[model samples]
Each structure stands twice: as C-alpha cells, then as structure tokens.
Target: MASNAFRKELYVFERGPEGKPVMAVIRNYTERDFDGLIRIQQESFPPPFPSELWWTKEQLANHVHLFPEGALCVEIDGEPAASITGLVVDFDPSHAEHTWEEITDAGYIRNHKPDGNTLYIVDVSVRPMYRKLGLGKWLMQSMYEVVVQLKLERLLGGGRLPGYHEHADTMTAVQYAEAVLAGELRDPVMSFLLRCGRTPVKLVAGYLEDEDSLNYAMLMEWKNPFIR
Candidate 1:
C-alpha cells in the first residue's frame, strides 16, 4: 500500500475524439452493462457460455454492490466497451488447494479472514474488437486506484494464462503449473501485464491441473506503488 493521498488520485485523458473513452467508476454491479460485458467475455473466452448464464439483469443487481468499491467500467461513446471487476478480499495461503468454485464462494477474501490482505482481481476483460488500443492498460490503471484506496498490500488470483496440456493426454497438475510459471512458452495475458508494469509476486506450484484443459491460473501482484 502507498500513501492514501497518492492512491485516491484519478488520471484522465481523452482516448479518442468523437468516441472518447469514458472511465466510469463502477459503484454497483447493476451499473455494469451486461450486454457489453458478456460480449467481451465471450469474445475473449473459448468454450463460450450462453449469454443467459451471466448476462441477466438480476444477477448484476444481486452482486453489483458486493464489491462496489473496486469494480469499474470503461465506456466508448456512451457504450460500455470494457470492464474490470475486483475486490479487496483477504488472501489465504491455504486456499491454494481449493477448487475455483470453492475459492469463488468461500475463498479467503469472501470469508473476511484477517490474513487476507491482497486485492482479488476476478475478471479483467476487454472486447476483442477493442484490443491493442490501450483500453486494457487504462482499466488496469483504474484498478490501481481501487487498490490504493483500500490500502491493500498485495494482489492475487488467476489471471489469464496460456493453453494447457496441449500435447499431453495426461499430466500432473504440478507439471502443468511449472510449465506455465517457468515460462516454457509465452502467455499473452502475462505479457500484457508485464508490459503494463506488473510483475509476478509468486507463481504457486501445483496451482493448476493439466488434463487436456485449456485454462491455467496466473497469479500476479503489483510491485510498484505508482501504475497510475
């Protein structure tokens, strides 16, 4: 955590002329534009899910204020173009063994443990059509503001990672975790974070399973005080 004064500041710039990107502070989940959010999620993800699974207005309203402090949305010309969702949850080192669902519901942060000191970035997705325009960087900067405001010491959770166990039919979870963490291959999400001045705090061993699965976990924490 940095100085409270430094953390509370906001940095604004015109991203475009007529289509200026609006950096809307997301206070409640209902304020999240589900249509745009779902589009970005689907376009950025494989094994695309039905829109109804996540895009319902009821779901948004139900969880909108749960993490109201850290959620944010980036709008383009009055339309939501990108969104970043996170929370100031306690981090439990023991939860490393927990399933994603378990972590999602009863994880360290959700349980309000005293040892949970890190900020949890749940989802950071930008529309595929809006890639390479610095929107991701902008959203990340916004996330920094939220973290600084909460005075959190570290960040944790599964960021985007490389494809898993592509060539192998069966492999140990530890082996797959090592491959991704050791940089056996390039990961676009990790690369993006690095480019935006974020570095890994720890690459947890046995953090992910490798069994013809496509998703792998990437745990990164912000080191610098100012990514604003």
Candidate 2:
C-alpha cells in the first residue's frame, strides 16, 4: 500500500541531492516493454530464457492484468531501462532443498502479517551501460518504501553468479566454479543489495557437468530501517 504520492514521485532518481535525467522510474510492465526487457536479460544473464518464452502477447496480457503487483519496470524518459520481478515468500533458511514456490505455498512465508511482514525481492537487472549509476539501488529503495508503507518487516533477494560454458576461448563451467571459490565472483544485482545494507547468509552452488563448471546462488537479507 505505497502511498500514491510516493509511487508517483518515485520516477525520479536522486544524484547527490540533485535529480538527474538519467533516473529510472518503476512502473507496470507492458507488451511494448517486453522486447527491451528480454534484450537486457539476454545480455545480462548467461543462458537467458528464449525470447519466445516471455515476449508473447499472452504473457503481456497476464502480466498487465493479473500478477502485475510485483512485476516492475524502470523506465528512462518513459522507455524501459531496467526491470525486476519480486514475490513475497516464506523464507526458510534451513530448507535447502525447497524451491521458491514450495516455500511460499506452504505458508512458511506469510502473505499477511499480524504486524510487520517481509518483501522477498526476486530477480533484478539493469541494462549494461547503465550499471553503477545507482538505478538498481534506487529501485530497491523504492521497493523498500513500498514495503514500509505496507508495514512489511524485511526484504530479501536470491543472488546468483552467471554460469556459462566455454565453446572455444572461454573456460566455461570451470571458470564459473573457480570464480565462486576464489571469491572473485560477484553479482552486480547482489552488490547493489549490499550497498543498500543486505547481508548474504547462504551460497548455493550452481554446477553443470556438461559444461564442467560451477556457479553460485547466494541468499541475501535486509530488514526495514536499512540504515539502522
């Protein structure tokens, strides 16, 4: 229940107390925005989902009218620049085997809180050239403000390292694993989370024998009043 004023005002990004034109605003996704979202995802993620999987008229219909609550897009001058998909889930740090759906469906995470609740942030991506400009961090803060208006308790994100296979010059799976082990690996989205005061509590390894490499899945958490 973010205030109408806050939601409306969120479109602008802050740059050292000055509003910059490069700011991104969060809005509901539309069919026209799908292609850009897909392109950004393809470039940002390894093994991205095929464009056909998501860029469909049917998907657009569902996203706009149905589950649009957590489907958010950040736009620059009304053009999509970044996007995120988040869902509130029951967080069970102990259940390593449970998929995201299972945890939420089982009521391990409560949708309605007797008091304060939590906002479980899912996927987030910013267009490559736009990195480090604070768009990602601003979007996250906007979500936090939304949760606060709704009196939610916390925020969370599933962090992952991009895993790829080498066909020629690339080291493929081995490089992915090495990066995970060496601590040289980092997820840009997760790094944004850290700048906003999140702590990584768990790391799940992503491995593909065919590629012969390993990736990583990290779990990060942040509570309200991010600055304490």
Candidate 3:
C-alpha cells in the first residue's frame, strides 16, 4: 500500500462516483521503479510470450539513461499501474515495414537519436485492473507533451492487435486492421490509438513474437498538432 503522506504529496485527487477520492499520479520513470514496472509488465502481458519480451532492469535503466524524458508512468493509489516507453527516431516510411526488433534495435533503443524528428513509442502497458479508466489516454497525452517539448514532427508506434489471434485464421493482418479501422471490429490497442487521433499506416507482420496478436501489429502515427 502507498503511504498516506507519499500519496498526499504525489497523487492528484479527484472525486469518485461514490464521492470518495480517487488518486492518480503520472510521472517519469526512475531507476528505483524497476521492480514495480517489471511487475506491471508481467501482469499486463501474460504467458505464451517469452519473459524475454519484457524489459530487464538493465534495459529499463538504459532507456532512462538514453532518454529520461521519454519514459512515463502512471501510479494509482501510489502503485505503478501503467507506463509508456519511447525513443526519438528520424521518421522513415520504410520503418513501417520493419519488425519490432529492427525498429527498436531489439529493445536496446540504440536507434534513439536526439536530433530525430519523430518520437517513436516503443511500448505502452497498463495493468489489467486499471484498464478502461482513461489512463492510457493520459499516458498518450504525456507523450504528446514530450513531443511538443522536443518539437518533434509526430509520434509513431506499433499498436498491438491483441484481438488478432481470434481472427487470424479468417483474415490477413491487413484485412483485420482495415476492419478495425472501418469500425467493423474493435482491437484493444488500435481502437484506443484511433481514439487518440492516431492513424494506422500499415500492418506489419511479425512485429513481435506475441501469440496473442499473432505476431502482427499496426504501424500507427499521430502527427503533432503543434508542429505546424
């Protein structure tokens, strides 16, 4: 449990439907946040996907070291509930055709270029218990804040199609993605990205080794409204 003093100091309070106060805090990731972030990743992404898919302490530390301002997290009641990790990269349309490993350089974020024009979102995770609370949107807004501060051209990322596994046998990844975009289907990640003003550019196959998404992901981009 979060200490009352810590909670009071860090969290922002809002009234719940029952008139009780709900606490939410959004902040940057720190080295000490490793354990909490790993736990959130574990709970958020389950089995059939190797544990290696999750970031190690060293990797998380490296991300913070390389791009401290790009890592953001949301804490609810003083516990880590969600996070978004990003890296700066020069925008390349060909990137939409690359696998996750190629795009992120195997999650080492070595492709992070300080002078890059685009902010590439590497991953976003929210604990199952905290889903549907608009926390994802809050995190995206935080990412946008970083984009504006950096004067980046856009935000880009691969949106996982967790709902793809069920429809994989019947349709191609692009077809499924088109359906989701057309409102004929709802994908947990893609739908949220669309709602946040992201446009799906293409469906990249084998983007990740996750069985749930059948290894397919949507390449999505959100142009910075402040860029113009």
Off by over 4 Å in 1: 1-32, 46-55, 93-95, 106-116, 164-184, 201-215, 223-228
Summing lDDT over every window of 10 consecutive residues in candidate 3, give the lowest-scoring window.
1-10
Candidate whose lDDT is highest: 3
Alpha carbon RMSD to native, model 2? 6.6
lDDT per residue, candidate 3, 1-228, as tens digits?
111111112333333564334577877878888899999889987885578888899889878888878888888876788898899988777645878787687878977899999899888888887775667887887788788877899999988899988998899888898899799999988999999888978888878877789888888888888777
Which 10-residue span in candidate 2 carries the lowest summed lDDT? 207-216
> Per-residue alpha-carbon lDDT of model 1 for 1-228, expressed as tens digits?
112212222333444654543344332223436666667677766464444434344434433545555456666555666776665565655554434434444222253333346666666777776664577777777676666666677655565455444533565544654554577754566667766667655444334443334545556667436433
Report lDDT (Cα) of residue 144, candidate 1. Answer: 69
Q: Which stretches of candidate 2 lie over 4 Å from their true place?
A: 1-6, 9-23, 46-63, 94-97, 100-117, 162-189, 206-215, 226-228
For TM-score, the strongest prediction is: 3
TM-score, prediction 2 = 0.62
lDDT of 3: 0.81
Alpha carbon deviation, residue 158, candidate 2 (Å)? 1.0
- Candidates, ranked, TM-score: 3, 1, 2
In candidate 1 the C-alpha lDDT for residue 38 amounts to 66
lDDT measured at residue 123 in model 2 versus the true structure, 0 to 100 = 56
Query: How many Å off is the CA of 212 in candidate 3?
Result: 3.1
